[model samples]
Target chain A: MSGGGTASPRHVITGIGAVAPTGLTCADYWSAVLRGESGIRTLTRFDPSGYSATVAGEIPEYTASRYVPGRLLPQTDRMTRLALIAAEEALADAGADPSAMPPFACGAVTAASAGGFEFGQKELEALWSKGGKYVSAYQSFAWFYPVNTGQISIRHGLRGPGAAVVAEQAGGLDAIAKARRHIRSGTPLMVTGGVDGSLSPWSWLCLIRSGRMSASPDPEAAFLPFDRRAQGAVVGEGGALLVMEDAERARERGASHRYGEVAGYAATFDPRPGSGRPPGLRRAITMALADAGMAPADVDVVFADAYGVPALDAAEAEALAGVFGPRGVPVTAPKTMTGRLLAGSAPLDVATALLSIRDGVLPPTVHVASPAHEHLLDLVRDAPREQRVSSALVVSRGQGGFNSALVVRAAA
Target chain B: MAPFPTFTTKQLVDLLRECAGEDEAVDLDGDILDLAFTDLGYDSLALFNTVSRIERDYAVELPEDVVGEAGTPRQLLDLVNAGIAERV
Candidate 1:
């Protein structure tokens, strides 16, 4: 339970930065979450003439020059640009010397669902329209791959073992889990989370083919994850980076810490169609509780992954009913207001959960008229709710059938 | 979306500024690189955002390379007009 020891599972978050539909930084994002402000806006990133979903939680006022150098900005796809900004903020908040830390001891693990599709599409269109020669050399590494981790490592001099997790939406929590494992295994520090930007015509065309995008033109009605009128999810883009380090090391360094423990993590896959959750999601929650060395009764809140799609929402509700067993744990899906961040979504939810623990308040799920299911969990709605949150569970499931759950505890 | 036509430099400047969501202070002939996309005072996200706006307002699907090629207002105008001509 201490640093400098060879055997300890303690991982403390030293700093955090998030570029969400809510806001650009942790504080601003958290504040917007409380106010129930929706970042969903009309499609300005790409024309939606032929698309089914024309709304998203687009990050407004994002300029690479504002965060990254103009010269390097052109080389980086929008995804990496967002990641770098979040990483820069997290590193500064941690006060870790990117230069001073042992390059091998400081590591990074981040996740992405769609990768750099916007940039990839630009290059792909050029190739399609003007032949292969028109494709930018940058496209070789920028699009649809897990290069955000590599890009962050290169830009920040983090030479430690870097990794990219591709678990779809749950990839965000999965990346944090991986970072915690590295820290436990003696990596001094790790920058971890999810970042992505895929709201482009190329990406949209693929999403439309999948038949999961919301078709409603009304912004409020477009992404109703747990509502009677719910159609499907709204695609969003952004990134969140948390500077995680050994708790003892953080204290020894007199570093300012945000939250206490990652506590628990579990992942599952529900591959079979119409099987609901394939029993894996419930098992994942149970495993996460066990990993936290706590019982389901110990959790103070549940951040549910209300997928908006009727069938998936039912599966999640069933999973919750089986695990929590009528405990009526207060649950919320603030992402309803901002649209889902895909790979970046769940980590932002985790961040919101952590901030809720810190602030002793719960954010509301905007626009859900009534609980979508009769599971009757205490769902926060319309406005922020005051609560004593000691520990919470955040859950998410990806499009290609990946499910993940994590337990986070407040600093004791 | 309206079809674009050959425009004078003043009209080109206005079109570029409108697409960029900025005012007329933008240099119509200056190096676009030196003018940080922000310095041009375009709304953040407008670098790519203006492409969508230009396409809609001018009814032209500009080439993706336009971001790299449209350094001056004249270039943007030329690109739009050329696309319009092709469509016509």
Candidate 2:
């Protein structure tokens, strides 16, 4: 096949930043993942005694004020604050100076499944208890989904295209994909990813209604993805963002670190069960591989969504079987330890994939001692797998049928 | 009658530095009588917080109208003085 049109400028991840349940920084999170450590524990953010789920993957110790400026604290939600910290770290990691680039040559794109739920809940409480007059003016924008993109751009003086994706669990990949598009279209750089904190009473109540969360009180077994005894997922808090830059521009800027290249991306939707169509995950994976001009065999590792629901788990395995056949690829779901972060999950998976490619090691799928079902796939478990991982495929499926897949290749 | 509590531009500068952070370039000795809050790195939200802190310390509530009208430190100081006088 002849390559048409100067193939869109290749995009590379120049920097990565994460605020996950296991750790506050990308290095800490990746270290915990390699050690097969689980961040799940008893839910102390609130008294879960009244709720069905008592365990969660909460960040060990986080103070938003530590990262956000005091002047901006009143205007920021926890989610936005987390995003800001991650963005700052990613820019530093990439050694990107937006001011050095043309002001309009850099942009920001963020994914947010739940926009400032904790902040909105607090505002609602004040309104109900103390009347409208007591409500904060910051409530108007802090609870907005696009507040992260706006804040990150304004803080760094990025005047290029900015957007926020709200595709639930799939939104994180979508944000990264959009950032890649932006970089291809003349933007030199983009700060993109998803971060969320929806552990408040109201957010938890809404999640409970979805019927996908594990109510197990035991932290070790609460969120067992791909295990025969799997119940459901645990709602996790925190997220990650990445600094994506044009490969050539990064090189020109003397950036010494490059995580990986965003080779290709594709998104699909699962029709309702009765629609008689194959699972959308298979299509997403196939499309992503094709977009990357790669074959299934080119992928070194597969990061499964691992929703932790039995039916969903089986369906994902079946999708993998259809794509790479039974035991076709080495698969892992480190999220079993971090719990399900909703939209924030996929970006962390991408970050993990980049680290895996860089270090040539695949992190294990913690807590899955027994195979959930018969499948033709090598599921990494118990201990980390050290191997040559030049390219990785990360997949995500949102609750409302959104499916997305991304291909990350080791920087050449 | 009790004496009215007074506020100086230096005190206002100090409050801004304390609330916004000492690293922010809030002119301490410059002629800030006509400088807007934004000039001092104070957005509307930060300005509101500064006003709240002053209210808490002075035991007086600056009117919402006064807050909206006071754009500079001098204007804010005048409003605070007026509020303290009314409260006393």
Compared with the true structure, what per-residue lDDT tens digits does model 2 show for residues A335-363?
A: 98788887889998999999999999999
Share of native interface contacts recovered by each model? 0.00, 0.12
Model 1 residue A93 distance off true place after TM-score fit, in angstroms: 1.4
Candidate 1 segments whose C-alpha is farther than 4 A from its true place: A1-6, A274-277, B1-88
Docking class of 1: incorrect
In the predicted model 2, the residue pairs found to clash are A326-A376, A327-A376, A327-A377
DockQ of candidate 2 against the true complex: 0.27
lDDT of 1 by residue, B1-88 (tens): 7644654556544544543334345554555533545456543344454555566556678897787677645566677778878877
TM-score of 2: 0.92
Candidate 1, residues A183-249, lDDT tens digits: the string is 8888888999887767778888887787888888788878876677889888788758889987877
